[model samples]
Target: MVYVKRALPPRKDNGQRGRVFIRRAPLNRKLRPKQLLSRFTVLWVNTAGVPFSTAGFTCRASSTGGTLLATANFDNFGTAIFNTIPTPTARTLVIRTFDADDNLFRTRTVRSGISAFAIIG
Candidate 1:
């Protein structure tokens, strides 16, 4: 009988370090609106401010059903991405905002601003 052992490089004491190992896999395909029926995120960015308005904003499909999915708020003007587990049949995009008086306003759309918007495997 023979026993074999593999040794790894010793860890460096330096506080800064790079990734030791990473699995290199092809990027996953973006989920579409129909596919989002399962659970997907809605990312949006409002340049103006909360209680959003017609000033316009952009949105993207961040991810689907997992830890990587997180919601975002518009501090100034940028990008927002996230995911969720909404009802498949209830697939829709809702944009909402408020005014100085706390007046709430929003809009809904069947199309997402993502490049792929709604594509399915």
Candidate 2:
């Protein structure tokens, strides 16, 4: 869970105008500390002959042991940003994609490195 403070908008109120506090819960429990989390980038797209877009796509990563690493949504550029606990050596991961309605659409095996990665799913 996290708390965010934002300035309150001006309105006719009996109390003084100040900041507002909003609380948000994380979608999933973090697997590692921020310092140990590495980001991976993946691009999901339509096939060469298929006319489609990767909009409203999201994905999650899991260890071969079946532990979920992290989840992220695709940006305008069709890149799914993933953060996970990385190993010193390359490791294999199971990455699954979902549609906007959270329906599972695709899955792929990825070999993870220390930096960002680009793979088509």
Candidate 3:
């Protein structure tokens, strides 16, 4: 599962506002037998198709599906932010799953092609 939360900008009357929360359901859609996931990786790329950063985590399967063995924060920008020039741009998210034996099982890529924007400042 993936979760993301961001603080909302301050309201005109209220100092700081609430937060925007997002969570992803378990990766069980169209799951196959013996296709247990052991590792998960997410890569963030710019509109130019240049990968800026990647985050990975280990998984442990259970009856419900799987749970991340380590704490993974999508907000951990690391070197990605410093390497990029901040501007109005779109990004792509690449999600990859691996099996227990370290074999990649599935891959999904989502592209936010610049049409969507939530302006805060």
| Best candidate according to TM-score | 2
lDDT agreement with native, every candidate: 0.37, 0.69, 0.34
lDDT of 2 by residue, 60-113 (tens): 888899998788888766777665544432678788888899998877887755
Evaluate residue 18 in candidate 1 and report its C-alpha lDDT on the 0 to 100 scale.
68
lDDT of prediction 3: 0.34
lDDT by residue (tens digit), candidate 1, 40-114: 433233444333222233333222222222233332333233344243424344433333354544333434333
| lDDT of candidate 3 at residue 93, scale 0 to 100 | 35
Best-matching candidate per lDDT:
2
lDDT of 3 by residue, 29-65 (tens): 7744452322333334456645433344222211222
Model 3 clash pairs are none
TM-score, candidate 3, is 0.21
What's model 3's lDDT at 96? 42
Count backbone clashes in candidate 3.
0
- Evaluate residue 30 in candidate 1 and report its C-alpha lDDT on the 0 to 100 scale: 65
Model 3 regions lying over 4 Å from their true place: 1-90, 113-121
Give TM-scores for every candidate, taking all chains together and pairing residue i with residue i: 0.25, 0.53, 0.21
How many clashes (backbone N, Cα, C below 3 Å) per candidate?
A: 8, 0, 0
Q: Which scores better on TM-score, 1 or 3?
A: 1
- The residue pairs found clashing in candidate 2 are none
